[model samples]
Target: MNVLEIRNLTKKFGDFIAVDNMNLSVREGEIFGFLGANGAGKSTTINMISSLLRITKGEIELLGRNIVKESKFAKMNIGIVPQDLAIYEEMSAYENVSFFAGLYGLRGSLLKERTVEALDFVGLGDKHKALPKSFSGGMKRRLNIACAIAHRPKLIIMDEPTVGIDPQSRNYILNSVRMLNRMGCSIIYTSHYMEEVEEICTRIAIVDHGKIIAEGTKEQLKSIITDTKEIWIGVKKEDALDLEALKRISGIISVRLEEQTIKIVSKAEINNLNWIIQQLIKDQVEISSVEEQAPNLETVFLTLTGRNLRD
Candidate 1:
């Protein structure tokens, strides 16, 4: 079942259109990756979904109810962890969670119980009494998450939830994302970190120039660029490589000699490996190893959008 459905969703800023006729859906139990470079309408779309901005046109449905018309119902079912920390610095960890949970209409013993549960889930149970000002970057990030989940919303939208944290903390949050999905919450996860999205997302959609340019699983997205393949060739002599001649070879799109390895992007259907090796041998380049590089999510993003995720 789809927990969220966006049909012809459009948002504008006077003369500028932020999101243009966007159509998307997030299935229940999916950690859906929503990716776009800066100023690509990604944040604008998210804001509209969270009801932070008024839509200029189209409908956004959260669990079958229109976000604009039935905002109360939508808000109750959706949890948002903004890219910017939404917790109060002076507030104790417990108070922070409780406050956000209370906004969802949780009260009395139920609010306190859910607050503590969220704290424990994020590994900040012992720090419940401590203020967020004293917490580490990762802990604060986790606390931000704790606040969002305290209300136990059916759908969670996490915007850059793992940014600027240590590897351990990032891993912790990634694991927590998976656990949340296991517990029956559909997630809309956006991150500049390609590997994070690649690692955890069940399906992904890439937006560029205010429109979705690609949408699919990692492998499925990679398949869109089936015309090209990347190959890494290890050589004993880097100086002996002929970069220009390699590019001139049939089916080879581009070539680069990096240190002791020659990187080549070529036509996927071309049988030019032997030809490349022969040309390299002619240049007195001794082959050490040859490996074909599989296209990853980052590759797909760059190929489709013509820009890096962080660009």
Candidate 2:
């Protein structure tokens, strides 16, 4: 079942259209990555879905209910962990969780149990008494997540939950998210970190200039580009010849010599490297080291948009 659906959703700020005719659907128990560069309408899309910002035109349905007409009901089942830390510095971890849970109408023994569960889930069970001000950047990020999930919402939307945290904390949060999805929570994960999305997302949608340019699983998206494998060979000596022959190889598209290094671009289906090595051996061309470059999310982004994701 699709837990969330956005149809022709749009949001504008005067003359600037933050989101344009956006349409997406997220299935239950799946970690869907909403990917984009900075100011590419990721936050704007999240805001509309969370009901924190008004939609200029279009519809959003959560759990089969229209968000605009049934916002209270829709929002009640969704938890939002904003990019910025939303906890109070003066409050302890326990207090912060309790405060946010209370806003969602959780109380008594149930609230206490949920608070402890959330704290433990984020690896902050031992730091329950620590104040936000005293915690490290990672600890604070964990606390922010704990507060958001204390109410046990059915859907969780995280906007760069691991931003600015140490490697340890980032791993902790990522694991927590995977665990939550395993326990039956649908998640909308947005991040500028391509590797993070590639690591965790079941599927991803790449948005740019207020539109979705690509959407699919990692392998599916990578298939959009024909040349998935790149080979680079380092020549032992600049005097070594056969560079022209390498470029003319059946599957080889282009070959360039930079000093003693030979860069080769070829069709992914062809084992061009092996073929190149064989030809070089026949020509007695000196070779140093050979390496294959596998296609990644960054490469896919560049191929489709003609620009880097970080740009």
Using TM-score as the measure, which candidate wins? 1
The CA lDDT at 291 in model 2 is: 86
Query: What TM-score against the true fold does each predicted structure earn?
Result: 0.86, 0.82
Clash pairs detected, candidate 2: none
RMSD of each: 3.4, 5.5
**Per-residue lDDT over 1-311 for candidate 2, one digit per residue giving the tens place of the 0 to 100 score:** 89999999989999999999999999999999988888889899999989999999999999999988998888788999999999999999999999899888888999999999999998899999989899999999999999989888889999999999899889989999999999899999988789998999999999988999899999999888756566778877546577788777878765667677776667778776777888788777788988886777866776666555566
Q: Encode model 1's per-residue lDDT on 49-154: one tens digit a residue.
A: 9999999899999888899989999998889998988889999999999998998999999999999999999999999999999999999999999999988999
lDDT of 2 at 292: 80
What C-alpha root-mean-square deviation, in Å, does candidate 2 show against the real structure? 5.5
TM-score of 2: 0.82
Clashing pairs in 1: none
Any runs in candidate 2 off by more than 4 Å, and if so which?
Answer: 227-290
Top candidate (lDDT): 1
